[model samples]
Target chain A: MFRAYSALIRKEFIQVSRDRNMLRLIFLMPVVQLLVLGYAVNLDVKKISLDVYDFNRSQTSRELVDAMKAGDYFIPGEEGQTKERRPLWHLADRFQDGSAQMAVIIPEDFSERLTRGENVTIGLMADGTDANSARIGLGYTAQIVDRYAWKHTGLSPPIGIRSAFLYNPETESVYYMVPGIVATLLTMVTIMLTSMAIVREREMGTLEQLMVTPISGFVLLMGKITTFAILGLLEMVIALAVGVLWFGIPFVGSPLLLLALAVLFLISTLGMGMFFSTITSSQQQAMFLAFFSTIFAMLTSGFFTPISNMPQWMQYITYLNPMRYFMTIMRGILMKGAGIADLAPDIIALAVYGSVIFSLSVIRFKKRTE
Target chain B: MNDKIVVQVENLTKRFGTFTAVNNVSLSVRQGEIFGFLGANGAGKTTVIRMLCGLLLPSSGMGKVAGYDILTQPERIKRAIGYMSQKFSLYPDMTGRENLYFYGAAYGLGRKLIGERVMALSERLSLREFLDRPSKGLPIGWRQRLALAVSTLHHPKILFLDEPTGGVDPAFRRTFWSTLYDLAEEGATIFVTTHYMDEAEYCRRISIMHQGQIIELGTPHELVKKHRAANLEDMFVDLIRKRESDNA
Candidate 1:
């Protein structure tokens, strides 16, 4: 059995190495995707245009505008880039033309309210077209206003927020995105390759030849999926190396634990690939199914959007997606250095899902071959 | 070769949906005999070979290959026979040597044993020159030789060649036939399917199938005389034509 398994893996590697396109796709795809998506999938909203409308023209209001400009998150809008004295009513137009993402209006009594020790109001309008930036811009606005009020009034708030972000202090989106991409790349490569493995043989009619041999269905499946599983792990390593070396993303957890869980993750994906192979006779069909499922898994996995932000029903549906648990596990391990105890639920869920999917696919594959 | 039977099937039948592919087919092939399975396209020739090779299950039938039941002992049957499919089934991206070694190991042969077999088969089949290059770019004749070597690598007693020389030139086909003769001489039972009637004439016995049933079974000269046809091709055409007319 070992001899047959080893030979099958060696043959797969030879075939993979011989095909230049597959070689490039296998080794280069993750690196290229990491470079592109690590930089492009940035959710960190910066350079938000804040059009300041100071009705008071007071020193306090000017200081407030300057405070908003202290960080890279906000850039004060020029007086009138498009038109001179752009009307405040044209706020909608400014947002429509993509000139300003947010506008702040300070009331006339802004300084008087502070001297009198009374509460003052400032109006901040944000374009909700890009909801993520809009929401973040609003949050920055609240922080700046609260600080300004406390500084000017000489009276501190009864309760102050000294919250510090855990795992990621500056909340760099790349730090979060790199690990997610690693998980996604592993899933994509393994599922696509394994899904195509058996189907390609069947399409080329090599499967019929293999079936006539003394090799059992179990050996064939093990040999094929083992090759892909190793390939998937190699892709993960490449993505991780790029993540840690190029992106300088810190790996906070036990590397051994991450590697162990990655194997667990591969079981589910490889099983899914095998299931697809049994159902589809053609490689193209298997590839389409794999692609569609990967996309579905990615979308629901909270890789792009947080599952909590999804509709309640969609959030419930995400529980069925193994990638969702893997995603959380990846981010937890890589960012927070989370141990298994902290990740027991997710790890347990993955184990259950992996075994069930792997066994089901294996059973179906054996039946199909027999 | 002794007179022991290697392949025997009785009332062999396979059905897909409502169509009966192999309709109660029955035939037996003896050790060292060259058995020709002849039919037009879609006459269920490939289906029958698929069943015999254990690639597909017979919907209803009883058969044995090398003393192993096709139904109850398919794994043993697989171990005891060799199958070269009609399609060039070896991995195209792999070199001929790699293909041979892979199949050799798949049959549980060790590394030294596979290497020895590869060396011997490459020499025997004149495949040494093309053994190092990928099989995809090799000429069809060379690829067929490589596939034949792979099928025979484990040295099974029974070999099933499905149109083993389908698109080969006459010279290559002659050489291929000589190889078959050598295998038969070495006590390997050959069950072959072919489109070329000349190749059919080379068979020790032939079964002519039409519409999923064997209408004639005998040696080439006996079949030609029994059907009163000029040659095997003419006899094959007359039999298929008569069957079509009867159906009409």
Candidate 2:
């Protein structure tokens, strides 16, 4: 059985090597995607265009406007060009025209109230279309205003919240997204490669020839999975190297443990590929099936948003998604330096999902031969 | 001649839902004989071959290949036979030599033996010049011959060929048949299905199947004589017409 399996794997390698362009693309894709998508997914809002309308033109209002522009988060928009100030209502039009993401208006008595030691309010408006950036930008603007008040009055607020970020203190999106990219890239490459390999054989009728051989279905499945599993691991290594070397994402945990979890993750992916091949009669069907399922898996895997934020039913559905657990394991190990003990539940979930899916696909593949 | 029966089928039947693709077919093939199966398209020749090769399960009845029950021990039967489908079923992306090595190893042949057989078979089939090229780049005739070489690399006791010369030129078809004769002479039973009536003449015995039934079975000469036809082609036509007229 092992002899036959090795022969099948060798044949796969020879066939893949013959397609020189494919060989190059497989290795190059992960690195390119990691760099390009890592920068693209950044959530740290910066250089937001700000439109300011100061009706008072007081020293305190000018001071407030200067304070907002002091940091990188907010920059003055076209409002700086006009000598005549626009009314507060026109701020809405400026936002609608994409001129600014935020607008700040100081009332006519804003400095008088500050000088008389009475409470005063500044009006702030923001476009709420993109909820994430809008919320973060609002928080930054409020913080800047509060700091300005403290500087002018020489009094701190009653409540001081000094929040510190843990794990990723700088809040670099790449630190979070690189690991997810590694997981997503591995899933794409492994599933697509394995399914295409099997479907190509079926389309060419070589699978029918193989069915007549002494090689059992279990042996054939093992041959295919093992070959693609190795390729998947190599892909992970390439992506991880880019994450660490190029993107500067930290890899603080045990490399051996990460590889073991990766193997388990790849078992699930390769199993899904095998299962797809069993149901699809042609390469085209296999490709569509693999592609749609990969996209679905990525969406529900908590790679982009928190699983807790999803609806209860969606959260339950994610329990069956192997990628969710893989994403957790990857983030835990890579970002937090988590050990096996810290990731026991995730590891168990992955092992269960991997074994069940792998075994089911093997059974289906055997049945398909008949 | 060896008296050992390599394949024996009794009342074998296969049904897809309500349609009976192969129904109550019974035949026996002896070692060292080229037994031809003749039928028109959709006549269930491929279905029977698939069942006998252990690639399909018989819906009912009993069959044995190489002394193993087809129902109980398909893996064992698979080990004992070689099969080449009507379609050339070798990997097109790999070279012919690579395909030979892969199949030989798939049958559990050792490295040294596979190497030796690859060399010998490539020489026998005159495939050495095309061995390094991908199978897809080879001419159709060469691809078919290479497929034959790959299927026979492990030298199984029985071989199943399903219309192996479907589109070959007459000269190439003759060469292919001569190779089968050589294999038969070496004590291998060859079970083949073809639409070509002239190819049926090369078989030691021929079976004609129609609409899921084997309506006629005999030596080519005997079948021609019994039907009072000018040739095997006429005998085939006469047999089908007789079945149709009987139904009418």
Candidate 3:
């Protein structure tokens, strides 16, 4: 039984190894995505774009302009010579195309009003596409503008405020992002590989051939799982090496714990994929369905947003996500230095998910000659 | 030959909801007998074969295969019999030798036995060079022969093949039928389902199913004489036409 199952898995791995392009994809694509999405396409935005239309050519207005240009919050654009400076503000189409993010507008008669000890209001507009960048751009500009207004007008609106993020600090989006990437990527690899492998057998007629043999469902499942679990471990090793060495991310968590958790996770994904392959009559349907499902799983699996942010019904729905627990464990270990005690719940949930999916797949496996 | 009734089906009935697949069909296949199951496209021959192999459950009645009850000891029955479906299916990505080893090991054969049989089966199928080639690359005839050899690796007391020779060349079909006869001579009962009436000429006894019931059962010669037809196919059409006329 062991040998039979091992043979099946080894056969699958060998087939995968034979395809050179897929081999490259399995190892290379992750690093490429990380590099591009990490440095270039980023969440933690820095330099903000602010456009100014200074109508009052007085020292006060000039001082206000210098102050706006003082810190990293603002990079002043060409004060496009025009009336009302709304046209200058309208020159913000470049920013909409990702050139600039935030713009600030100062009103006319600025010196007379300030000298008379009257308050002046400045207008600020922002591109709010990326909520994270929008927040940064909005916060920094609000602080700078408020300080200038208070010194000149002697007016303070009294409202105390405090804001905090629960999990990660320094707001390093990479720290939050890498853990989710690990879960999403692992799911894509394991399920696609196993489902494609089994579906290929059915297409090529190997499954019906194997069914005639004395290879029981239990033996077949174990063999396939163990073999692919090793491949999944290798994938983890490659991903971690890139994360640590190339991207300068930390391996603060236990590598052993990560791999062990990953094995259980791989089992669940592969088993679910197997069940999927059996239900589907054609290879194309199986592949497309697997793709559709894993994408949905990643989208809703707490990868991009906090579970608390979602409504309770969606939160309840996510309890079924294997990657939800995996993402929690990965982030906890890598970022929070969390141990088994901190992750006992995740591990148990993953174990239960794996066992149930595996048992159900085995029970549902129809060995009919038809 | 082995003093064991290798397969027994008594009043075994399987129904797909209201559509009965096999209706109270009782049959016994003794050791070393080649039993042919014949039917048109929708007949229950394949369903009966599946139930006998323990791949499907009998809706009602009792059956025993290889000294193991079909209902209670299905896993044991599964362990004791070899089966090959109509597709001549083998994993295309793996080589011929790999396919044999996979099946042999699945039956709990040790590495030594698996390795020896892999070589022996390749030689028997004249698949020496093709042993290294992926099964998908080989011609269909070789695949059929290879599938037959793999199913017989563990040498189960009974072998069930569903239309194993459907589309092969005449020469290859001859070899496949000869292989079945050889297995029977070696004390293995062969239960085969086929549409090729010429293939039916080789079986010692044949059961013809129309709709859900085995309407005719006897040796090929007996069936030919009883229906007053020249061959099995005409006999099939004759019997079905009569059944259709009677039903009308």
| Best candidate (score: TM-score) | 1
Judge candidate 2 at residue A167 and give its lDDT.
47
User: Order of candidates by DockQ, top first?
Assistant: 1, 2, 3
For B179-227, candidate 3 gives per-residue lDDT tens digits of: 7877888789999998888898899889989887889899999999998
* Pick by TM-score: 1 or 2, better one: 1
User: Model 3's chain B TM-score?
Assistant: 0.95
Give chain A TM for each model in order: 0.72, 0.71, 0.68
DockQ of each model against the real complex? 0.62, 0.58, 0.42
B187: Cα error in model 3, Å = 1.8
- Candidate 2 lDDT over B1-248, as tens digits, reads 48899899999999998999999999999999899999889999999999998888889989999999999899888889999998879888888888988998899999899999989887778888999999998888999999999889998999999999988899899999999998999999999999999999999999999999999999999999998999999989888988889999
Please give the RMSD to the true structure for each candidate, in Å: 9.7, 9.9, 10.1
Q: Output the lDDT of residue B140, model 1.
A: 95
Predicted candidate 1 versus true structure: per-residue lDDT over B124-203, tens digit per residue? 89888999998899999999999999999999999999999999999999999999999999999999999999999999
- TM-score for each prediction? 0.84, 0.83, 0.78
Grade the docking of candidate 1.
medium
Worst 10 residues of 3 chain B by lDDT: B1-10
Best model per DockQ: 1
Q: What is the DockQ of the complex in model 3?
A: 0.42
Off by over 4 Å in 1: A44-163, A367-370
**Residue A178 lDDT (model 2):** 85
